[model samples]
Target: MSDTAPKQRPQYRNISVPQILSYRLPLAAKASILHRVSGALLFLCLPLVILPLFALSVSSPESFASLRSYVDNPFCKLIVLALIWGYMHHFCAGIRYLCLDLQMGNDKHSAKKSATAVFAVSLVLTAIFGLKLFGVW
Candidate 1:
């Protein structure tokens, strides 16, 4: 038998809070986390922001005009833009997850590609809607 010793495997350890900030997550993991965040944002805003605005807008002509003006402010526009991004990202990621459930793109390479595609498509869609919202024509 040879005298050489077998190589030891690297030890795996739990990441600490400080290390977490600097730790690099894989693209698919990042996308999955963001998907959860966006879903939460949508769920919370539906009750807090969207429902209130819809109720006010449909209440009366004056309320509708006020709502329109409120939405026209640059600050409000930015918030709307954020909501647009959240909605788009959540929708794209949801579809990706559905495909995953169906066993599509189940491999590592395809998973990464789909994650990248989700980001790209969501951002592109958000940009298009943002341009319209800002009256960019």
Candidate 2:
């Protein structure tokens, strides 16, 4: 066969379900993308973070007590916990992406490793803070 005789190009248009999921993409890829999204959400959620600090720092003892009481309430506690998860997830994911930027965890296995690291850090942080918030720590 001649080199230029009816050369056929390979087709690259097929996709499979499992072929899509574990195709060996980097762990840091999804983590980094989610990190950016979470960071944006946390930024947009500033009033929620700042208001608590402001309420705690600037108010009188009684006012702070009132704020504390509200925070201690179950509904507020859950909301605060969700915010904590948001912040912790963003922080851990950010660190993972930073590692990726340093050329670490860019492979599929390494990326999964980094993602595991992200979850472990986020979970530990959440548990610590969660217990503290619930006065169990």
Candidate 3:
């Protein structure tokens, strides 16, 4: 004579949009998100900003000088810096993804380490390029 009862399972709630700000995502997730963001940014900027600037710069000597003058502004420099960062992050994250696709760093710890490496390497590369862009010796 034994009584049997169904065990209750814990319910999981979906986080609301506002709750996302407080949510602590794992490093790999954060890196993946940023990878998508950087890719999108590069895609958007390629035609809108980069192509026009590039065409202007290479069109003529006067246009090249004009482009140089425009880029001499601190605001433009910051925008270029942002673009550099986007490219750097995208490149680093792309490599990380390639490694993932090859089944490298598939474990949790390795994935976390690779994600951290992506961020660190991207930032470091961006910093180096930023310094060059800023004419820092």
lDDT of 3 by residue, 26-91 (tens): 999999999999999999999999999999999999999999999989999999999999999999
Which model scores highest in lDDT? 1
Highest-TM-score candidate: 3
Per-residue alpha-carbon lDDT of candidate 1 for residues 1-137, written as tens digits (9 for 90 to 100): 56697877956597778877887998999999999999999999999998898899999999999999889999999999999999999999999999999999999999999999999999999999999999999
The digit string of per-residue lDDT tens for model 2 on 1-137 reads 77779967857588778767766655566666767777887887787675666767577888777778778888888877877888999988877767878997678787888798897889899889999998895
Candidate 2, after superposition: displacement of residue 114 in Å?
0.5
TM-score of predicted structure 3: 0.88
Cα lDDT over the full model 1? 0.96
Off by over 4 Å in 2: 1-30, 52-56
> How many clashing residue pairs, candidate 1?
0
TM-score ranking, best first:
3, 1, 2
lDDT of each: 0.96, 0.79, 0.94
Residue 124, model 1: Cα distance from true site in angstroms: 0.6
- Alpha carbon RMSD to native, model 2: 5.7
Better of 2 and 3 by TM-score: 3
Error of 1 at 84 (Å): 0.7
